[model samples]
Target: MTVLILGLLLFLGAHSVRIVADGWRSRTLARLGEGGWKGAYSVVSLVGFALIIWGFGLARQQPVLVWSPPTAMRHLNALFTLLAFILVAAAYVPRNQIKARLHHPMVLGVKLWAFGHLLATGTLADMVLFGAFLLWAVLDFRAARLRDRAQGTVYPPGTASGTVAAVVVGAVAWAVFALWLHAAWIGVAPLGRTF
Candidate 1:
């Protein structure tokens, strides 16, 4: 639990610099130069991510039950996760309506993913892990929106073809992950069957 908390602090804290201290981040970036800043950031992120994986695995071994969620929550999580995948896809798919409207589809996707997992899982580890991410995403998204507004950011209008492509790519990726990769990687099959 301590390790998990530490990992979350390191990981989420690193991620929160832009949200909480944009000026400081800009100053540091200027001081360090792009390559140096990126190298340091990548090293910290990697270490933090590795620690999260290890600590999560350890915490799962000694399960601490919190509240038993209704079975329906799993189905809801599935739906949420599916949408999350689409939103994430929108972040990268050029001229997608989702991105054009949302302006920060990736952050929204993270928010959905964290919230969905929190709804479905019942354990201290789950709460800490998902809750941290949920809080972070909320703050990050708000900060990003504020920044965009301040910067006078303008998103391009989405094309029908690009929107369709994003949806198709997202759905296929979600299906592949939910059907096979979820069970293989996470050791839990949300849809009850795995390939």
Candidate 2:
């Protein structure tokens, strides 16, 4: 638990610099240069991520039950995760309506993912891991929107073709992950069957 909390602090702390200290981030970036800043950031992120995986795995072994969620919550989480995949896809698919409307589909996707996981799972470890991410996403999204407003950012209108592509790509990726990768990687199959 301590390790997990530490990992979350390090990971989320590194991620929150832009949200909490944009001016400092800009100044550091200028001083370090793009490559230097990115290299340092990547090292910290990777170490934090590795610690999260290790600590979470360790915490899961102890299995501290907080609450027993209804089975329906798992089903609801499936829907949320599916939509999360689509929103994440929209982040990359050029001219997609989801991105045009949302402006920050990736952060929104993270928010959905964390919230859905929180709904489905009820353990201290789950709460810490997903809750930290949920809080971070909320703050990051708000900060990004505020920055965009200050910068007068304008998103391009989405094309039908691009929108379709995002949906298709997202759905296929979600299916593949939910059907196979979830069970293989996470040791839990949300859909009950794994191919």
Clashes of each: 0, 0
Clash list (residue pairs), candidate 1? none
lDDT of each: 0.93, 0.94
Each candidate structure's TM-score, on Cα atoms with residue i matched to residue i, is 0.98, 0.98
Model 2 error, position 11 (Å): 1.4
Look at candidate 2 and tell me the lDDT of residue 114.
97
Which residue ranges in model 2 land beyond 4 Å of their true spot? none
Cα RMSD of all models vs. native, in order, equals 0.8, 0.7
lDDT of 2 by residue, 1-195 (tens): 888888888888899999989999999999999999999988888888888988999999998999999999999999999999999999999998989999999999999999999999999999999999999999999999999999999999999999999999999999999999999999999999997
Determine which window of 10 residues in candidate 1 has minimal summed lDDT.
42-51
Per residue, candidate 1 scores C-alpha lDDT tens digits across 47-127 of: 888888889999999999999999999999999999999999999999989899999998999999999999999999999
Reference-based lDDT, residue 6, model 1? 85
- Residue 25 in candidate 2 has what lDDT? 94
